[model samples]
Target chain A: MKSALSTLLQQTADLRQAIRHKSHTGVTSGLVQGAMQGNVVILPADWANEFLLFCQKNPVSCPLIGVSEVGRYDMPELGHDIDMRHDIPEYYVYRDGVKVESRSDIEDIWQDDMVAFVLGCSFSFENALSQAGLTPRNVEEAVNVSMFETNIETVPAGRFFGNTVVTMRPYTPKDAIRAIQITTRFPKAHGAPLHFGSPQDIGISDLSKPDYGDAVTINDKEVPVFWACGVTPQVAIRNAKPPICITHAPGKMLVTDILDTALAVL
Target chain B: MKSALSTLLQQTADLRQAIRHKSHTGVTSGLVQGAMQGNVVILPADWANEFLLFCQKNPVSCPLIGVSEVGRYDMPELGHDIDMRHDIPEYYVYRDGVKVESRSDIEDIWQDDMVAFVLGCSFSFENALSQAGLTPRNVEEAVNVSMFETNIETVPAGRFFGNTVVTMRPYTPKDAIRAIQITTRFPKAHGAPLHFGSPQDIGISDLSKPDYGDAVTINDKEVPVFWACGVTPQVAIRNAKPPICITHAPGKMLVTDILDTALAVL
Candidate 1:
């Protein structure tokens, strides 16, 4: 008789295998519900040190969870048999700071000088919020979480610098407080929110037209709560103008064997 | 050489002694800064059990920290040699749920059937907020915290039932988020706020006219934050119409030896 834990492990392994074989190329949000899903950033070794410093300086936006050794694809610390080159469902390839192509697998472009950085994503805490009976509207509506580019600037590190990007989730003031408490436990997944009320306070003008991802409903009684997002580091990478950079497509992620609860601070 | 702990102990004892002797009969808001101060409720033995159940049902508003044995004036668990009959700066005496007199000591009225209830007060968390550099406006202005009776009803128990009463403080949205996180650490001291933003949302009509305590300045950028107040139980007791009841005068709390941080959840 297979226990629930063993079943979950097998399911995670099967999903990763499907991704590796180019058979499951879709957004990883809401998939493998309790596992830690991450934002992928593959940079050449020459630029990896600067990116690492950027993450340390702006931890709320770029919470680094697992960083692979130079030229290695396996993140053993993050998962069992996780291969960075083919594990993410979709990948965005960039050249000289501009996104040039999207691919299901980056095995052909895997460089000897590449270093893979897996960052903690908001999906981990979103799962926690759902478990606490405060499901984010994006998940309830079965759509992508809303993302916005803000005027709030990230601290500069080496050649990396840009304004922060944030993801928005709407909740009534009562539920927002509970969500804040729940998310505060997952520091690796952006911890608590950066702002809650008026979007203009953070320089976001329109809530309806987001810079990325589809907009979810914000009811009359609900206030939009904004969190520092994983997309922030991608914007910084663009500003740095690295010759080559790769990232998981927005909403698409690399699912790990690590349990989401494992990232909680308390 | 007196260590800091011993010094704090001496100061708390000195303050209590002063209050006991009627030398210090003012509000205890900022006095004995880091020590725990509590709201007081004295009820006849017949009604004590119902009030006890009320506190249990509404823990956030009436977080019971210590209760004296019936007919006993001393609360050893709250402080060394603490005398509830005289340690508070001022007492409000009620006859059939109406406040009839104010006195420095209740020795003449103290009955063998009276039971003294000490509830955790917001002063503990307000001190913590000040320490975290988010000074609550009431503390800054050296005034009692503004409190309002909200439409949010408390869970009724026996004859005790009334709408929740909340204390208000003003802060910018950013500071309010930080305040929420800081105050969440002290569950016994009202924990996190009950509501934030518009006054009308929680049934507060005007910010300037508080049901109890003086109103402090709410700057243009600040949003009013509300917490479940210790005064809540007094309102419930009023509704219950106990024949004879006593409480600390508004802002006049019973100073205890326990450190404010002693009640923090994390």
Candidate 2:
């Protein structure tokens, strides 16, 4: 009889295998249960150092979990048998800052000097929130979390610079307080929230119209709690205009074997 | 040469001596810096058990740090040579649920059946917040923290039952997040805030007119963050209509030798 932990691990590995074979090429949100799913960023070696500095300076927005050596496709620290080129369910190919194409795999365009960076995503904490009975609205609604661009600027590093991007989830004050405590444990997954209450305070004028992803209902008694989104790095990369860059498509991520609870800090 | 820790200890002892001698009879807010200051409650032996159960059931509003034996005036666990009858700067004496008189000391009225309770107060965490550069508005203005009676009910114990009382501090969303994290470390000091943002959500009608203590300014960009107040037990005692009840006057706390940092959980 397999334990629950072993069952989760088997399911995670199976999902990754399915993604690798291009048999599962859809949004990875709420998939693989307790396993970590990360945002993918692939840049040429010439641009990798600057991007690393960006992540270091703006840790809440871009929490770098695993960085592949130049031209390497595996991230052994994040998971066993993880292949950067094909593990993600879907990939976005960007040319000179503008997204040019979406593909099931990036193996054909994978460069020798390409470096893959895996950033810790909010999915880890979202799973924790659900287990704690505070399910994120996006997960409950089966939609992408609402992502918005804010006036809050990121600390610039070389050519990588842009305003922050945040994901919003509506929760009542009581539930929001508990959510803050629960998420504060996962610093690798953006940790706590950057702001709550008035959306306009952070330059988000309209919660109904998000810059990316579908907007969920913000009830009369609920206030929107905003966390620094993994999409923030993608916005910075777009501004930097690296001649060629690769990223996971919105809501699509690289599933890893690491347990989400393993990211919690004291 | 005395170490910094020794100096603080000496200062705390000296301040307590001043308070005990009636040389200082003002609010203890922001006084004795890093030392723990507590909400004082004195009740007869017949009612002490009920109140103790109340504190146990409603730990946030009445966090029990030290409770003196029946008919005892000394609280050695809280501070060296501490006299509960005179250590607090001021005292409020309630007769059959109604506040009858306020005095600098309660030595004349001390009874053989009396027990003293010292509850954890927000001043401990407020000192920590100030040290972290998030000085509470009440401390900055040298005013008592605003406290309100909320609709949130405490878990009942015997005859002691009433709605919770909460203290308010205003901060912008960003600062409130940091405040929540900082205060969560001090569970004895009411832990994290009970509510933030909308005042009506917690049954607070007017920010300008607090039920107890002086109201502090709430800035334009700020939202009021509230913590379960130490005054809650007083309200419960009032409703219970005990033959006699004694407590520290609003903002007049019993200064203890316990270091505020010692209460931090993690």
Candidate 3:
């Protein structure tokens, strides 16, 4: 049974490889469905300890899944022979937390002192929601999910803290409640919502002008439900002003062999 | 350990008895604090089946914890020997789901074919919320919790179907989200909130004119938080229009011996 499950999961890895080969490079949203995907954060060893503590303090924002040995390119626990450099369709390099460049791989920039932290992503629960008959609108529209920054404070760690960044999904109050319940089962994926209803309540001035990703239509009867974004710790990293940091560009996630059901608490 | 827990629970029984004796007959707020108290519903066996199905369909509203066998009044699991006739400080006798009269006890009205259902009450979570340092304003002010009937529909079960009734507590949208997280852990006590923010969205035109219970303050910065109510099934019972039914008067509930921990999912 384990081998059978593993065989099915390898197919997911094969699909991710296809996406990596530019055969399926476009957002990787619906491909390899039902597998848990992760947001990648790689940083120098000097800032790695502080960033680990930051994720511990602000778990809702950065749920850490696997941490690689210093300078190690292999994230064996995340997937079989997962290469951090080329697996992601895109990458972001930040200097002092400001985006400096984008690349398809970082083999040349790879350093022995760098540590890769695999944080859980909302795409995990997005799959669960869709399976439960509440398909997320962003998935239906074939767009990157909207992202926003909220005033809600994250627990501060040494030189690593910022307000939580949240991803927005429009849901009717009824659907929003169900979404809250469904997302809660996957705590590693920014469990539950940080806020719902008015944008003003969370220091958000407008729904249309999102800080990152495209804003989808929020129907009149629906409210924009907010979940702590996987990118939140990235914001914290930016504020921390690390010498060098790398991340999977938004919407380009690290597909893992883990099944979404493996994370359910209930 | 069982005996020790039971010994601790005896204190609650003592307080409940004191309330019945008029030695402790206020709102029962903060009385016997940690013990699980329940909303009481009593009905003739003929109407009991439908009401049972209603509670089954509307678990958030009428979470049936212990059901007394027809023609019996004992609930050993809830208490050592809880006498339904005079145990509660208050009681409301409903004829056809419309409350007709109330009394301290109904030994005279107690029927041979009557069955009793005791549901986990919101007070269980009030204790939890208070401990978490988010005690509601109504509890702080020593007033009845405000309740409203909503346009949200309940799953229909035979003749027992009506829009859900919800209790209102005011909190900023951010805090309301926390409350939803906290209360979602207690499914026996209504689970997460049904709606928040707009009263009109759920077909409630006025927040001030609550259909049941007293209205409380809703500050400007705060959004009105709503949860499924213990009284929701009572409203459905009214719609069902049974020949006879009895329930604990509003704010009055059956004191049970069960520890609140018994109901917690996590």
Model 1 RMSD, rounded to 1 decimal: 1.3
**Candidate 2, which segments miss by more than 4 Å at Cα?**
none
lDDT of 3 by residue, A1-266 (tens): 57867776878789668756757555666667778889899999989998899899888889999999998888988788788877888889999888899888888999889999999889989988998788988998989998888888888888887888899999887778778788888899888888888788788999999898888988888888899888887778788888899998888888888886777666
Clashing pairs in 2: none
The superposed Cα distance between candidate 3 and the true structure at residue A128, in angstroms, equals 1.3
Candidate 3 deviates by what RMSD?
2.8
DockQ of candidate 3 is 0.59
What are the DockQ scores of the candidates, in order? 0.69, 0.78, 0.59
Per-residue CA lDDT of model 1 for A1-266, tens digit only, reads 99877777888899999999989987788988898889889999999999999999999999999999999999999889999999998899999999999999999999999999989999999889998999999899998899999999999999999999999999888898888899999899999999898899888999999998888999987899999999898899889999999999888888988889999989
lDDT of residue B194 for candidate 2: 94
Q: Which lDDT tens digits does candidate 2 get at residues A1-266?
A: 99988888889889999999989987888987889989889999999999999999999989999999889999989888898988988888999999999888888999999999999999899988998899999999999899999999999999999999999999998888889999999999999999999999899999999998888988889999999988898889889999999999878888888999899996
Rank the models by TM-score, top first. 2, 1, 3
TM-score of 3: 0.91
lDDT by residue (B1-266, candidate 3, tens digit) is: 46867676778778767866767554665667778888888888988888888888889888889899998888887887688877788787778767888778788989999998998788788888888878887788787787788888999888888888888888876677667778888999888888877888887888778786667887878888788888787778888888778777666677777777677788
Fraction of native contacts (fnat) of each candidate: 0.47, 0.67, 0.63
Candidate 1 structure quality by residue, lDDT tens digits, B76-133: 9988999998999999988877888999999999999999999999999988899889
In terms of lDDT, model 3 sits at: 0.83
